[model samples]
Target: MKIGKQDATYQLERFSKTQAEFDEHYEKDLQPIAEKLEEERQKTMSLAKEQAKKLIIPALVALAMIIFFDGFRIYVIAALAAYGAYLFKDVYEQRKKMRVKIKEQLLTALIQFLNPNFTYKPKSYVHRNQFIKSNIFKDDPNRYSGDDLIKGFVGNDDVDANGIKGTKTELSFSEIKAEKVEKYKDKNGKTQERVTTIFQGMIFVVDFNKDFEGLTTVVPKQKGLKISLPRFLSGEKGRRLEEVELEDMEFMDKFTVRTTDQIKARYILTPGFMRRLYEFATKKREVQPQNTQKPETLKEAVKVGLNVGGDQRRASQDARNVAYFSFRDGKMYFLLSTGKEHFESGLLTPINKSLVQEYYEDINKSLELVDELNLNLRIWSKE
Candidate 1:
């Protein structure tokens, strides 16, 4: 199998010539282009940082002034004002950030929806061995306004260690619970063995009765919202929690919704952000004033509201009724419009049902596309 030394030498020389040519070409051509690109990127970043510094100069000036002025009360007031201004700026920025996140989450969902193989319509999809049917929430033209439909499914139940059998009171909210330690298929071809519950009957229709109306109630002294969710019956009681009152604070609304709609494999949007910027930009907008028509109290901080003058502005004391279909985790979050905002208090709300409907319908339409394209993409990736 051994070859002669002369033949080997000839092969080695040939290889050396090719290697030399490759090194020369790559260094002269590809390397320069890559280096130039890197340099341009650095320059762009440097310019951006410089611009940011210039924009922030006023904040620095305010800080320096506060430091220079030594009178105790004056200094404190000045410092507080400066900090407050910064806090306001930060809040506006954060709201915009949240909006962007929401947009991303929605885009991802829409992509998922568009795909036929992964996510078809809610109803008539094959789930494992079972062929189940589900209705797309938006597809139903007769959908109710608010969460009145969801509210009917909450009540006291006889949940024991053996498992939830039935409800104590014969109410619509008391749903017939279902368990899954084995395997079950939902209508959309999703296979899961996790224990879950679904509301039964024509009157009651829902699952995961948490934050009933998607309306969050803030805990009395806590910064977070207090949400109430039903505890499903699981086998074998633990040390203490198996025998607590249903109204126990420990079993309250602690589960935060996947509101942060950031998606790497989808589009997203944030709410109540751009409007806030517009508010701050235009100082002291004339809105509905209280009884006195003047600022007599402290709580009426809103300076923007109903301007009953312009027709195109669409000024009305009452906000329009709308609906919500928030998709998070693996479930759809639904909400109904409660009422319109009062026209007097500059309370423009989600009153335009048409606009809200369009948003919801568009999401439903886009979802299949999103699912088809974003099948294997990482859910939480921002990029």
Candidate 2:
């Protein structure tokens, strides 16, 4: 017995509707593109390491061959600087180009997966606040390549004067925006004043399973925005690098931090950092005579403050009045504390009302100005 023509038509229409629903609901089909981009990222990163290794190791080896072994002493330092700068330019630029290319390609690939014929045309560059007619480069003379260009723009005597009608900074420097502040607390509930106000930079090393997605680790759209330092910082010992502290919140007004409860609880040490420390220790330890000299460089200032030179090494986690946050489920937990001098001791997050009131008490009217058009701030420890 053959089915009726009308029945067959009805069945086909029902199947078409079901297919559309499935496409809208499930996105498993797009996984391959995401995974491919991640693979490309890994490959690109590996290539970068190879370049750095080739350049740095050979440069150091060449210097060693000329120095202690060949008595080239003082000149080795200069040679090393020149050689290091060249390799850095080549390798660093290449790695940077590759990353930008891959991320752009990844975005295109994602769009393609969503709509196969979506024909993505990537932008040449991502601008910071292009919606406004102002050029950020105009106000920040330092952002330009040369002092001459800046000097030419603002002639000798003109540079010293801030005349009202004189061509103002190329940018509308007056257009201020909202500022976000991260408040840290002691157990007794007092906020610690940062040693440095310009916490304009920080580096984060987030660890997860190799199978995990890289995008999950990135803080969203953070470039160019003013940043505040996080409450804590971490570091590696053997890299000749010192303290890896969180952003000095003193720098930015807004920030968003995330952590799962599991990651918060473990607070794992970076494996690569531990490996470097062990390797440096095991290698023929060079015992050098101690030289007492005052620091001249900015980094040296920090090293002296933290006692980071010679054999006197301290852990990044050793900084006092530090707080560590762990986000599990959805709640935040602050584990670190001020050493009996400040807080009562214990965790503090999503701070209580009493704590908030106490913090505002320290706020000075002159140091802070937050309105619709302006955001001004100048915070420091009270003497």
| Clash totals in order | 42, 14
TM per model? Answer: 0.18, 0.24
Top candidate by TM-score: 2
What lDDT tens digits, residue by residue, belong to model 2 across residues 264-287? 322322333223222322233112
Model 1, 207-286: lDDT tens per residue? 32221221111111223312222121112133111211123232123212222212310222112211221222222322
What is residue 180's positional error in candidate 2, in angstroms?
16
CA shift of 377, model 2, Å? 32
